[model samples]
Target: MKTDTRPILSALPEILKDRCGAFICCASYEERSRCISGAVKDLPFERVVIFAIADIFSGIEDRALEIKSNFSNKTNSEIVLTKTHEPLFTANVVAKSLRRIMDDGINDIFIDITTFTHELLLILLRQINRFKDRLAKVTCLYTSARSYSIGDPDDRKWLSKGCKEIRSVVGFPGLLVPGRPTCLIVLVGFEHERATRTIVEMDPELLLIGKGIPSVEHLTDESHKAPMEFFHNLVQTMVSSRGSVEPFEFSCREPYQTARTILELVTKKPDFNHIIAPLNTKISTVAVALAAMANQKIQVCYAEPETYNFNGYSEPGDKVSIFDLDWDREL
Candidate 1:
């Protein structure tokens, strides 16, 4: 199947008119998650699973229950509150559900990727990719935000507050080198603190800062320009001693392009042990997963948050992008 990406308004029901046999999504405090879930509420769903992650400080139980009530669980649906940070546990829940769906002979699925944590989203996508052989259609739906962290931008009050741990994703631990300087490539987002915190923790010898390009077709420019510049300024302050801190641009909306962009960076710095830490949008993390999976030499890392600013993370945008993704597509 061909990979088709479509960015549309939720008001246009005619676009996602096709029925979905199963739905998978994470319950999050962000308004965009609610908007995306509501937008797909009318779609026919025999099974639905809303993963409510119970990490130490993030609070989202109420919202998960609210979202569960709106969807059609004609056959069965569940709100599983998994009590662990292990990415494989999340993978197992999704894998078990996929196995059941395949047992029932359903080959199509819809995944709402609006508010999954970067780490969680990567795990889910990898799991979905594993079952691509049995599945016919994998449609990923995401709602772009109108704005992020409505409060003071520098404070980043609405995003995560502090970094809990900086580590490689469970399955995506890239290769190690006996004698090589480490180069950390970060996909910067609204949370400037987290990116800076990652540098403080990893102490990578070199740095490649990834600032988003607003040129993406799905996401309009300028709304993100000011903050992106802010992100660049803070992340560059790390001052890598081995090589000068470099800056790179990638589409904030497109995944494959960003994957290639990261790959190009990896090519230029072959002497260094490459580590990709994504503190960016869910969409860009999609790129991180694609890039890391494509190149085992590229390890993907995350700065797990100590706490999130659940008060005001983001408000939902009117536009929603739906991708009929072929998980098995070569990168």
Candidate 2:
């Protein structure tokens, strides 16, 4: 049998030769390493940037140093270590830093959010939006490495909502790509099929609507209605709450189309208070961008199976489950 490694190898050179930069934000050294390794193996870019959240780096400095040494021979890579203990790397700071990096002419940026808070990821996405036009291709990789406590179900749900908001914004042009498995796909309750018809008729927003677990999976088909229904229901829910809602549709299979849809949405709707997203590694970056675009306070709640407090806080010792929510609502 003939083997086909050509596609993989071909993509590598393009990714490597392309102007690429990456950011890895997490609370654990092991998580950071995994992100770094995954990035290196996937992209063939000549330049790579790795940023680590401070809390996870404190105890793993020695290990980090070792990892850095291992890659010392690679001339096109650089690592940025930030201390989460300090207030310096705030969302605005992260945004500015990313702008600087992109201004320096590095395209194809990647961010890994395996161990960071949903808030931090939002900050990064906001920064990416600042330079969407100037930057090349930006990709975010979300890995489910951290476990949330059982006591914070509300928190998890909030986080999931925040992630959806980020997707709304990042899915815009010159922003990050969506439909990747890492992107979050929040399933609002299934409603009547008329929900999809309403979305088609209104055509209020530029959205990538489809059916399937991952947006990417339904990208190839142009007739999927789940996304449209989701959007329609979301609009109805928002309007019912006295909030204005807009919709935009795009081809999730094509990066440019996805980006264009996002850009259009941003241009058309400037009064939306918040963008709700799911809490998954794949879609956190999108949440980040929405928070920035709205310039409003971003809030998240996780939806893990862990028990939550009456006030929606999670205890430290609870066992986190899947179904975590990633969302951002306007404050």
Candidate 3:
């Protein structure tokens, strides 16, 4: 990780100028289409591809039209609708779309995984690794909310309806061999209730990784403390504690390193069941996704929030961390 943080205005010129990018997002009842469209409108891309779930196309019709309208006058934009439930199928569709763009002679690419599910991220990362040599540079983008709402009690729907609670990440084909040490590697984030559910449900050897005490500048001190403490308490609540929770510095953050660490620590043990829940930074989520791609026995799970604080979760903060990965070198 480098100190590449900048405001969206400062960052967009460099990232989106003359670059062919794809925005893989989920459309819901909320303002998700607006969120996706709003960001892409600012970018000066040669071509932009929007990948969304079929349900999103049908369910969020008006916003979808608006998104298309937003980009119609600017760049040559296209929307690819896919079956969001099937990870492998979705990956195949996205891969073909990206390859078609490459066939059109656009090499340098950026992927906005901000609205993607953990499974979607995993498969897409795997697809990117496959086509690494066809591109000059690859950059992954994510939008982090300033504050996440636990949600109002009256809300009954999820913001990301396209996501799956649990899925078998591709590259992991079969069940784990018997008598293996099953481990659950969790990247701790804000949700205590979700984290607790994961701990209770999986019951694997717990391996926790989270941000350091004094986290990054963007996160409020109170907001940061809550998640860290929640992780600690969740671990303590476990009757058979696996071990200690680990912390990583914001500046030294390495998604690939984090993924590689998980492989070195658990997968290499042989005959293991790796269940990863990435509730941390998008970069860290990428790390976990990479790890899931490395082996066939691993499973990735996500517990989507019932409701989002759409109003409170402000965006495009002072800093934007750009996580770069050279697939050939890293993988």
Candidate 4:
């Protein structure tokens, strides 16, 4: 059966119309094509400029050319495909190329680079800002297929710290750095305990299993029975006490299924306030593009992690203690 991807494509029109620029980055050629197809279906292709990288370029060129050749092509959107043999290694060069493209009177651009790393994204982001006058709005997309858990102590510390640092530097509002390891964040109100419980219970345990750790042999079976039971119980407890919760999961790899799943949930529950995502390079560029296209109040949070500090120029003092946590009367 074909995958039901309507949820992801639903809010795209609003996002495209509201923003002056859009960028989509994916991990693979196939995903790039799929994302492009879905994105173009709703966006105003007449003013759009798509920049495809490497193997993805080859696949999209055929479609782009065919579209250009067709008489019914009512839009003036242009698709430029380029090859990058060593993408991550040459991010600075790629950023310069992108800057040149943006300078060519094209305000809206979509970039697809799922093969690169978070550091490369940082480089690109830095460069994009260099030509901010030419670019009114910029959107970065990221994609990954796995799901991560926030339960890991080490992972939480890294993400929380990273988010704080990025916010201190960038100052973009609505900065949501979810604590979950998976990139998907679920916003459930205090009242939807039953539904939340059921959804969590149905989640696959294998989805939560991380790398290096031994895979649970019975994950599939156990997940089928009640994969997110522990999660649901925890949520139920939190809700019963009148506390609200926002839970997210970050996957380690590309083409994150968790993102797709969360998009589906949002479609069914449009009443939810908003979805906040961290503007980290680790996320798939395609996913970022997809999120940008959504109609909800989009907020970008920037964080420059202390781990990236060099020359002893780290942010002075401990920023972690600033968070609203009670250490004196601890549990």
Using TM-score, give the best candidate's number: 1
For candidate 1, lDDT tens digit of each residue in 1-331? 1123445556635665676577888887777777867877777777787878876435678878888888776347778665446767766776776677778777888888878888777777777777788888877777767777765564343477777777777678889797899998988877777888887677788888888875545343347677766667666664544365787888777777778889989998889999998887777788788888888888888788877767677767777666666555676
* Clash statistics: count for each candidate: 0, 66, 1, 33
TM-score attained by model 2: 0.43
Better of 3 and 4 by lDDT: 3
Candidate 3 RMSD to the correct structure = 4.9
TM-score of 1: 0.90
The estimated TM-scores of all candidates read 0.90, 0.43, 0.74, 0.34
Worst 10 residues of 3 by lDDT: 154-163
Could you tell me the lDDT of residue 256 within candidate 4?
30
Cα deviation in Å at residue 21, candidate 1?
A: 2.6
Instruction: Using lDDT as the measure, name the better of candidate 1 and candidate 4.
Output: 1
Model 2 agreement with the true structure over 1-331: per-residue lDDT tens digits: 0011112212332434443454334434343344334434544444445555555335545544444444433565555555433433455456556665666677556554444444455555556665767655555443322322223332122211211112122222223223311112221222222223333333333332222233533222222234334444554554343222333333323222333344454445443322333222324224334433543322222221211122332212111111111222221
Q: Which pairs in model 1 have colliding backbones?
A: none
Model 4: CA > 4 A from native: 1-7, 20-28, 45-47, 55-76, 79-81, 86-97, 104-123, 142-331
- Model 1 residue 205 distance off true place after TM-score fit, in angstroms: 2.5
lDDT, model 3, position 10: 48
Cα RMSD of all models vs. native, in order, equals: 2.6, 12.7, 4.9, 17.3
Candidate 1 deviant stretches above 4 angstroms: 1-12, 56-59, 153-158, 216-221, 238-242
lDDT value for model 3: 0.56
